[model samples]
Each structure stands twice: as C-alpha cells, then as structure tokens.
Target: MEQPYTLEPYQRCGLASLGLAALRAEYPGLSWHTLGGHFRSSQPFWAAIGANVPGGYEQRGVCSHVTSS
Candidate 1:
C-alpha cells in the first residue's frame, strides 16, 4: 500500500521527538495518552512514542496493546 505524505525513514525518530518535546513544552506536566483508533501501520509509532509520554499509552478504545516495537 502506498502511504500519503510518508515521513523519511531516518527522520521519523528525530521528528517525532521534536514534535513531542514541543508539545510537552507547550503543556507542562500533562499526562498524554493515546486516544481513539489507530491505523494498523501507525500503531507502532504511537506505541513507541507513547512510552515517553507521562503515562504509558493509555489505550482507551484501541484494541492493540501500545508497546514499543
């Protein structure tokens, strides 16, 4: 399957990190959780980043366990 506006392979980590850091900076001491449904492909990314969040991915309505791949 083709991905739309897919991120470069090497840029994923740095980009995600920066984005999350910016969010944290904007909202200090806020608990971040993964809410709603995640795509089968994006699930891995969500799980990976969710770990660094204040709480491990609080898988609300998500079916799969959010864990680092």
Candidate 2:
C-alpha cells in the first residue's frame, strides 16, 4: 500500500487515477480485507507518527496504549 502514494507530489486528476490503477495492477496479490484489518489495527500508531507540519506537532492528542484503551 505504501508502494507509490507515500510522500508523492501533487498530480492532475486523470493522471492520479491512472497512477492508482497502475499501482493496483502491480500488486495482483494484494488483499483489501487483510489490508483493512491491518490499517484498523495500526490507526493509533499512525496517529502517533503523524506528519511533521508547520506547527511542529503531529502526534495523537492523547497517549494511547493498545491494552489500556
């Protein structure tokens, strides 16, 4: 899933669609169901590592532990 989209620059709408299609074609064995499961499980981790932007803040607002929450 991180094969192409991560940190990419802007693109026109048509080319963006084509790029997504190409990415899909390249990963024939990819499973959306498994991907969704992992994504769901990792949401908090992603929030913890959120983008560093102008304000120098990106992490989750609250500390979250998998077992605690």
Candidate 3:
C-alpha cells in the first residue's frame, strides 16, 4: 500500500544518499546550475544536500549547462 509522506521514514534513513549515488552511477558526468536565488529558509537545505556531490555544485552564474567528464 502507498504510505503517507509524514509517516515515511526518510528522515533517519539513507534514502537521499542512495538516490544520489544511483544517479551518479547512471550518469557519470551529470551536473546542473542553480536557477536564480534560493529562498532564505531553503538555502541550508540546498547546501546540505549538494555538499557531498561527486562533481560539486555552483549556486550562481548565468550558464545553463555544461556536460563533460
């Protein structure tokens, strides 16, 4: 059965990390740029998630995308 969002146990699990690792494996050189400015309250959340990305994250600039290894 489908579970409710609040009842889901993602908080104390490695769900996010696992998902990231899977994506990295599927797309070796995948990367992305931020869209404008982030909400003040969400800055911390964004920082925390991308802090350990394999390539690195740049939350600024005008370039849309650059694909390479």
What are the clash counts of all predictions, listed in order?
0, 0, 0
Q: Please, what is the TM-score per model?
A: 0.50, 0.26, 0.47
Q: Which digits, one per residue and each the tens of the lDDT, describe model 1 over residues 23-59? A: 7889888754444455787777767766776664535
Order candidates by TM-score, high to low. 1, 3, 2
Q: Which regions of candidate 1 fall more than 4 Å away from where they truly are?
A: 1-6, 9-11, 30-36, 61-69
Candidate 3 C-alpha lDDT tens digits along 1-55? 1221222556536565566668778988876454455668555655665678754
Write model 2 residue lDDT over 1-69, tens digit each, in one string. Answer: 433333335532345345544755788544232122334644543334323212322333332332322
Best by TM-score: 1
Model 2 clash pairs are none
Worst 10 residues of 2 by lDDT: 50-59
lDDT of all predictions = 0.61, 0.38, 0.57
> Pairing residues by index, what is the TM-score of model 2?
0.26
